[model samples]
Target chain A: NAGVTQTPKFRILKIGQSMTLQCAQDMNHNYMYWYRQDPGMGLKLIYYSVGAGITDKGEVPNGYNVSRSTTEDFPLRLELAAPSQTSVYFCASGLRGGGDEQFFGPGTRLTVL
Target chain B: QQQVKQSPQSLIVQKGGIPIINCAYENTAFDYFPWYQQFPGKGPALLIAIRPDVSEKKEGRFTISFNKSAKQFSLHIMDSQPGDSATYFCAASPITGGGNKLTFGTGTQLKVEL
Candidate 1:
């Protein structure tokens, strides 16, 4: 089903620059999440959506935004990037929320300088 | 505060040996605990999971042992192989609320030497 897919497998941005990390899932999952993984660390949630038009902040949502306009799409936007934002970003999808199995995409490695 | 904590930042074991990775959580509301395995350049994939109601769960060569009172859980790889080497993450989430957002532990890198 191609599960979940993310664009720009790798990217580098200058300070104050902006970019969008695109994600899509063919599984028609109703829940999608965006997480960042730092070196030697686990994932930290940036933002998530229960469905199209419903988004919420997660543990670390600063400097980022998200939009889920369709069941298959959820994109994360980084505005005025900073070096602290350098990390690997992952996009995941699930048929249901709360303890449900989440399918993850290969992730985009982002570097902000 | 880090709700979930994992130990052994890295582990090396010989093939056929058993490698156990441990995790602990502080949230009493968390009911579901899961372990994810990630290979280089790839996203994390679900390995095995356990609910608080069960003390243990096994799937193939992987097993999850849970201690409800201690709020701790562990993953054990039996007869480990080089192919089983990967970064393992432990995560927890409540079943009802917060959109089931997961709190993850710092990963443990596992290496199996032949």
Candidate 2:
């Protein structure tokens, strides 16, 4: 299996611009999550989905949105990007629940100017 | 507040030496603790994990030592090598509910020198 894959390995956006970071998993995991890692900091969750059509806000979900229309895809949308949003974003998926080990994508390095 | 706290922001050790990274948590409800290793420009990967019920778990050269009473845990790399160098993160999750969302600690950058 390809496990989890993310697109646009690197991206740069202007302030107020928008873009979508795409994530997909071939493992048919029921749980998917979006997290951002800042320099010298731990990852902060942006959003997550327990299953398709069920999404929830995480600790830092202010400037982002997510949709999990299928078990294979969970995409994160950044609207009206700001410089504070500059960070490396990761997408992960797990078969069972939050207690399970997650498969992560390579990551998308995003820069907002 | 930061639910999880990791220490020694960075660490450097000679090759073949053992490196230990520590972490502590405030939430007693957190039952699952995991360690993740991330190479530059890559996402974190699970290295090893421990549950509060267990004192220690070992897998190959990696080990997780847990202290339930102290509410702390640590990762130890035995006979460390240059390839073992990376940013390590410690995370915790409640046994149930919250969709298993994890609270991550500030990472520890490990460097193994020749």
Q: What share of the true interface contacts does candidate 1 keep?
A: 0.79
In angstroms, the error of model 2 at B43 is 1.1
How does chain A of every candidate compare to the true chain A by TM-score?
A: 0.98, 0.98
For residue B80, give model 1's deviation from the true position in Å: 0.3
After best superposition, candidate 1 residue B89: deviation in angstroms? Answer: 0.3
RMSD of each: 0.7, 0.8
TM-score of each: 0.99, 0.98
The stretch of ten residues in a row with the least summed lDDT in candidate 1 chain B is: B94-103
Candidate 2 chain A TM-score vs. reference chain A: 0.98
Error of 1 at A80 (Å): 0.6
The prediction achieving the highest TM-score against the true structure is 1
Q: Note the DockQ of each predicted structure.
A: 0.84, 0.77
Give fnat of each prediction, in order.
0.79, 0.71
Model 1 reaches an interface RMSD of: 0.9
Q: Model 1: per-residue lDDT, tens digit, A62-86?
A: 9999998888999999999999999
